[model samples]
Target: MATVNLDLTPIHQCSADGCTFNASASCHAPAITVGDHGANHCATFLGIPTKHSPTNDGHVGACQLSDCSHNADLTCTASTIEVGTSAGGGTECLTYSAA
Candidate 1:
């Protein structure tokens, strides 16, 4: 199988203990998608047991919230970001701001 390499740049700080990709306050996922289904939330978030402290840090691969000020060309331009729970459910980008 061919492995695809992602050259992610945006920094994503994941603080959700329930996320399988969170490791030592950092995100370990190869890439993470921000903005929920028609809402501001972390859609890539997955709840699982046995959290492993992965060495790789998470990157904001994409942002669907077109109204967010940090979004540019469908990508997140924030220098830093965080993932946390919201009233909707799961994780949401704490740094999200209106344009």
Candidate 2:
């Protein structure tokens, strides 16, 4: 039996079609990092053409959005985060909000 530890994992929903970690519109990386890489994006993003897919769910590992309320010491404090390109392009944390 597998014990679910909520504290050890962070729910991260990604909707980047070209991302290698994106599987069925969800991120399959074990962990993801959000930062200002050409505008707050999923630093873990890898184009599908550049690699294969993952077999696991993604969790928010770190966040560099200092203006966001979920950012605590460069880490994401949110229990869950959404990643999308609608926020002015690129893979950005849709859940990012003003502090």
Best model number under lDDT? 1
Supply every candidate's count of residue pairs whose N, Cα or C atoms clash at under 3 angstroms: 1, 0
Which lDDT tens digits does candidate 1 get at residues 1-99?
Answer: 223245454445666878888777788776778877668877888888877567556788889999999899878887778888776665888898999
Which candidate gets the maximum TM-score versus the true structure? 1
Stretches of candidate 2 above 4 Å error? 1-9
The estimated TM-scores of all candidates read: 0.82, 0.78
| Residue lDDT tens for model 2, 42-92 | 788887575455565678777777888888887777778888887466778
Q: How high a TM-score does candidate 1 get?
A: 0.82
What 10-residue stretch in candidate 1 is worst by lDDT?
A: 1-10
Which parts of model 1 have CA positions greater than 4 angstroms off? 1-7, 87-89
- Given candidate 2, what's the lDDT at residue 75? 72
